[model samples]
Target: MSDQPPSHGTPYPYAYGPPSYAAPPPFRIPDAFGWSWDMLRVHLKVLLAAMIPTVVVGLVLYAMYFWRLVPIWIDMAEPTTSSTVQLDRFQDLWATVGLLYAAALVVAIPLSLFHGNLVRMCLLIADGGTPSYRMILSTRRAGRVMVTTAVLLVAGVLGTILCLLPGIAFAAFSMFTLPLLLDRDLGTFAAIRGSFALVRAHLGLCLLTFGLLIAVAYAGTMLCFVGIAASMPLGTLILVYAYRSLQVTGRTV
Candidate 1:
């Protein structure tokens, strides 16, 4: 009777808290790959434009290796007239190798600065936003991206020297570092940590994505090496799409 009488004032049992909503499930492998391909198809032009720097740098590096490194190796292999001459030639060979490496870094470091811009463009396209070539070319986070890349390269090389597994693990953990750095404006270490966390949380999915991308790139290579121009950008778009889906679902590392 008292409850009925109090009906106008409030419910018989007052609500204690806000209603809860269930979280969405993690992205399945098929869904992730499908979405990535769809996004790539939609933004094909912009994605291909983004790959220009990568392609150019790759060509330059290849040319340098073929022209400079090959001659050095050939000269080093040939017989020399005397011990002193051999020693001098060996020193010259080392000097040439060092110079070639330095030259590569000089060219590659600047070109790699564009990677952040490319990732940003991919993310923008994934979010249904149309980004212009001029806008995509603006690399505000180039310095940070370059530094992070150098760190990862050193870490990967050191890990590889120690054991191959650690190198693979480092690469897997860093799959999202560039995107995280660009999107979040995070410091290098923070972005790296975030990427590691994301990968650690979804290790199997990350591995699948990574392996599939490598396979795609390899296929591109097999097709007279011209396929890389298309495959590389497509792979990048796929990664951006996967990252977008994870972010949307609030699946942080």
Candidate 2:
């Protein structure tokens, strides 16, 4: 018999099963930082644009806080040690504190949105997608992001107050929550749980990665506090890259 069917309508071949796919490569912590650095170099403009607003907001808030308290501080510093004067200064200090608290409350929503967008931007870069400044300003799931942030803040504060280790663990495990929310469209609590699962699977690696990121951020702050403009984005990109790695390696929830 001929090896192939003679002038058959279909090509002669043995039955073939479904194609096989190669497993994704193992996730490497170093690759995350390396790839993030590459992204930073190539996408500097977009990253910097996304980062500038955050820095500006922080600076403006700090300036406002000090400006409001400067007069009270000066009054307290003056040598007019009268009981009435001291009482007035104390009242002024309390009023200033309340005003700052109100201002922070008002700013918290937008700040949370910005942070979520930063994660979104870094995730996009890590996924080999182009990101823009406009995209940074345009955020989705703003309400969920804000609520999730509030939950984390409260939990982290309570944990820290009770014991240091729980707070540290929370910070490490929850690092990917924002990325999960943006990438997987998960609800707030679901994203938090997913992040916990991911970190749990590779607890040591995740903790080491988180610690390195903190070091990078601290180094940036040490650069006359201006290096944060670059370090923050770089650290975020590294984190997003690691999150992507976990997804590909099937380590993510």
- The ten-residue window of minimal lDDT in model 1 covers 1-10
Per residue, candidate 1 scores C-alpha lDDT tens digits across 1-253 of 0100001122244377754445554666666556666666766787777777767777776676668767767877888878997888778777877787767655656666776777787777666687678855786877888888788877876787687989988888898998888888999899999999888877787889889878878988776556777786667766776676566455675
* Model 2 agreement with the true structure over 170-211: per-residue lDDT tens digits: 989899988888889999899999999999988887887898
Highest lDDT: which candidate?
Answer: 2
Local distance difference test scores for all models: 0.72, 0.78
Q: What is the lDDT of residue 181 in candidate 2?
A: 88
Error of 1 at 187 (Å): 0.4
- Where is model 1 more than 4 Å wrong at Cα? 1-25, 68-106, 223-225, 248-250
When superposed on Cα atoms, how far off is each prediction in RMSD?
A: 10.2, 9.7
| Residue-level lDDT for 87 in candidate 1 | 89
Give the local distance difference test score of model 1. Answer: 0.72
